[model samples]
Target: MKIEQIYTGCLAQGAYYIVSENEAAIIDPLREVKPYLDRLEKDNVTLKYIFETHFHADFVSGHLDLSKKTNAPIVYGPTAQPEFEAIIAEDNQIFEIGNIKIKVLHTPGHTMESTTYLLIDENGVETAIFTGDTLFLGDVGRPDLAQKAGSVTQEDLAGILYESLHNKIMPLDDSITVYPAHGAGSACGKNMQKETVDILGNQKRTNYALNQPDKESFIREVLDGLTAPPKYFGMNVAMNKGGYDSLDTVMDRGLNPISVEDFESFAEETGALILDTRGPADFHKGFIPNAINIGLKGDFAPWVGNLIVDVKHPLLLVADEGTEEEVITRLSRVGFDNVLGYLKGGFEAWKNSTKEIDEIKRISPAEFAEAFNENSKVIDVRKIGEYSAEHIDNAYSRPLDTISDWVSTIDDSEHFFLHCAGGYRSMIAASILNSHGIRNFTEVEGGFNGIKKTEKFPVSDFVCQSKTL
Candidate 1:
């Protein structure tokens, strides 16, 4: 038997492919299904099952499309109320695929229908357990995401998670491999380990959630310090649950290249957001006026999901050449399917057309420190956790995640200097500030990372933060 974890670093999500005796099964697939189709064709295996741990809130799953194309049955654990036809397997039920068996263990903690699949080999020995969001490498899933479903409270879900872990998951043998849905950089869990895979035994010993001696302690720890999930999470979950347009359809509509005239006209007609997915340096140099910069270099999809709250928000892209398709695909991954099209010839086309262009002022960190010494207002757009850890002595904590709530607090008259840990988020903050007509600001080029490296800057020691959303 061959088992592979197809990990997508962009989403910090893992989808599994298991094959044996010319039969294959896919677990928790991304929206784009071509890769999985290619794999099946290459292996000459018939896809037998598409297993979903739950209706995910992170990204749209490819189950419906895969099932439609391959005639594979979509399977879920008990209590799943999908809009379409699916096999809701009972707890502890086993399904056969070629020479191996996959046993469904209904471990509903992260959500009401969350499940883990135990992969039993041809020898009839449990080899590995695919723990969706129920368990991570170092932390378990947060219990708050699905709290509104069935009018259940987060504490109630935490209690259920505790029972699910102790009763179903903890009983498994230590040697079985544990494959989770998401790793670090994901909002699903706090303080997730960077490692993607771990032995169940090692996890039991190392994972704080698993090592908790009592259910109350486990729930408290699991639910502690969870920042609000992104606004787009619920919409993504709904799309995953009710089904969404196929990736092919979404791309067919989104990948069209429009001329500068048509791009601007479309934006005016539809009120489409102009999203510039270029490098931070390129974006800072010049961009279409009023465009928001969420660079494609780092955490692009999740950041888009966070800032662009509307799942159906129409977007016009200003991506570098040869990256339009990638930009569209990543947008679709996060449930942003209403992409109108991309600017033909990228931002250059608009520039050559003599269209009005805007540029953000970027100052070197050394320059920032020099100006900061003179009493320029500074805004640190890092998360509360990062702000609390250590920051410039006088920097105000205005985290980018919840920027809309407190962004108006920036005085219209003051020329503020903005920075995040690195320059990426600060540029994002800059764009948002620009959009709101608050452009009297200078973005620190290297942000706090470069600021702290210079001896002229005053870096503060770690201090406990009291800010909360």
Candidate 2:
């Protein structure tokens, strides 16, 4: 028997592959299904089933396409009412895959249909548990996400999760391995450990949620400090519940190359968003006049999901050479299927064509410190938590995540210098400000990390009361 955890770093998500006696099963696959298909073909194994822990809200799952291709039925736990055909397994039901067995544990906390799959070997010894969003290494899934869809309060979900963990999962043997859907950097759970796999016994002792003595305390602890989920979460859930466009179709539409003339014309005709997925430094040097820069290196998909807001918004791409397909695949992972195409010949084509180009004014940290010492306004575009921890003195906090709401509040006449924890987020902020026609600003190169190294500016560690200048 072989069990493999296919971890995707960008999404902080894990998909599992299990093989027993030439029969295999997949759990929680990403949008792209070709890799899974290739693996099965290479191993000469027949896919028996595709298991989903829940209807995910973060990324669109590949269950539909995988099932269609392999003739494998998609399986979920009780109370899951997907629009498509699926087998809703009963709690504790046993499924046979060649020499092994998988037991369904109806753990409905992250969502009404959330379930964990327990793998039992040929000898009937319980082994690993695939605890989707129900349990992370260091934290439990947030209960607030399913309130609207399940028609239950977050408190109600939290209580159910408590019962699910205690009654269904915690009672299992300590030797069992725990494989979760997501790790750290995922919005699914707060305080998740960076490690994807852990022993169940270790989680019981170390995870804060698992140690909670009562349901009430668990609910309060889980719900505290949950910032609002990204706006595209509900849209992703809807697409997952109901079916969505095939990955082939999304890629075919997005990977088409368009000349600079057609790119501009398409933008003017359709008003599609021009997303530049280059590095932060390259983006700051020169880009299309209104292109939004969410670099491919940083948290690209989540940032796109947060800032774009609409899943079906027609988008045109300006990517580095040979990376157009990668950009499209990543976009499709987040349910952004309406991508029009990419700029043919890359951004250099536009520059060569004598097209109107815009550039962001980037200054060194020393230059920024010198400017700030004079009569310059500074805005630190880091999160409130980071701002409160330590920030440059007199610099106001305006996070890049909330840029849409507060972009209008910035005075058009005043010049503001922007910086984030690193240079990536500052470029994103600068692009957003440029799109809003507020271009009278200079971005600090290397952001606060570089700024703190220069002792010319005063850095305050105390929490500040006001965030706005």
Candidate 3:
């Protein structure tokens, strides 16, 4: 038997592939299904099952497409009322693939349909458990995300999660390997560890949520300090729960190369958002005026989902020449399927055509230090937690994720300097400010990290007491 964890770093998500003899099963697949199809071909195995832990909110799952292509039955746990056809297995029901057996454990806390699949080897030894969002390495899934209107509250879900963990999961063998859906960078769980896989015994000892003395403590800890989920989460969940257009169709529509004249006309005609997916440094040099920069080098998809908020919004791309397909694929992962096309020759073509181009003013950390003054305005675009830990003495704590709430209140006449941990997020802020016609700010070249290295500015350890705008 072979077990493989296909981990995608940008999303911090893991999908599993298990093969025993000539039969295989896939768990929690990404939207693009080519990789899984290729693997099945290489191994010469027939796909027998597509198992989904729950209807995911972060990215669209490829269960429907994979099932259609492989003729495999899509499996879900009880109480999962998906719009598509699937086998909703009962709790503790076992399914076989070749020589191995998979036993379903209905662990519904992350979502009503959340489940963990126990892998029993040919010898009937319980081996591994694919605990979707129900459990992570350092923390369990946040209980607040699944709350419905006037129905199951977060506390109710938390109680259910506690029961699931203690009654179903904790009773398992200590040696069983635990593989989760997400890692540290994901918003699904606040305090997930960097490691993607761990033994159940180690997690029981180290994971805070697993060690909570009682249900009340578990609920309070899980719900505490959870920032609001991205606005696009519900949209992605809708697409995953219902169905979406084929990835093939989305690619065919997005991969079209449009001329500079047509691109400009299309933007005017369709009112599509121009998304520049180049690196922050390159994008700072020059870009199409009003284009938002969420660099492909960083956490591109999540930032797009957070900032853009709507998956159906039409978008026109300005990507590095050879990376258009990649940008489109990433966008599609988050259910952004309305991508019209890309700039034919990238930003260079727009620059060469004498189109109105805009560039952001960027100052190095050294320069920022030299120009420091009591009257200078600085904006820290990092998260509130990071800003509270340490930041420039008098900088305003305006997190990039919550920019939409406070950006309109900024006084355009007053000049400001912006920075994030590195330059990635600040550049994103700069572009958004530019789009809003508030371009009087200078972005720090290397953000707070660089500012610290200069050793000139006074860094404050005290939490910022600035009033929310």
- Candidate with maximal TM-score: 3
lDDT of each model, Cα atoms only? 0.91, 0.92, 0.94
List runs of model 3 lying over 4 Å from the truth: none
Global fold similarity of model 2 (TM-score): 0.97
Error of 1 at 89 (Å): 0.6
Candidate 2 on 1-469: residue-level lDDT in tens?
9999999999999999999998999999999999999999998999999999999999999999999999999999999999999999999999999899999999998899999999999999999999999999999999988886456899999999999999999999999999999999999987999899999999999999998878889989998988888889999999999999999989988888999888898898988999999998898889999999999988899999989989999999999999998899998889999999999999999999979999999999888777775567888888887888888877788878888888878886888899998899999999999988988999999999999898788778755536444
Identify the superior model by TM-score, candidate 2 or candidate 3. 3
Report how far off residue 368 is in candidate 2 (Å).
Answer: 1.7
Residue-level lDDT tens digits of model 3 in 289-354: 999999999999999999999999999999999999999999999999999999999999999996
Clashes of each: 0, 0, 0
TM-score of each: 0.97, 0.97, 0.99
Error of 1 at 106 (Å): 0.3
Residue pairs whose backbone atoms clash in candidate 1: none
lDDT of 3: 0.94
TM-score for candidate 1, please give it.
Answer: 0.97
> What does candidate 1's lDDT look like per residue over 50-161, in tens digits?
9999999988888999999999999999999999999999999999999999999999989999999999999999999999999999999889989875679999999999
- In candidate 3, how many Å is residue 184 off? 0.6
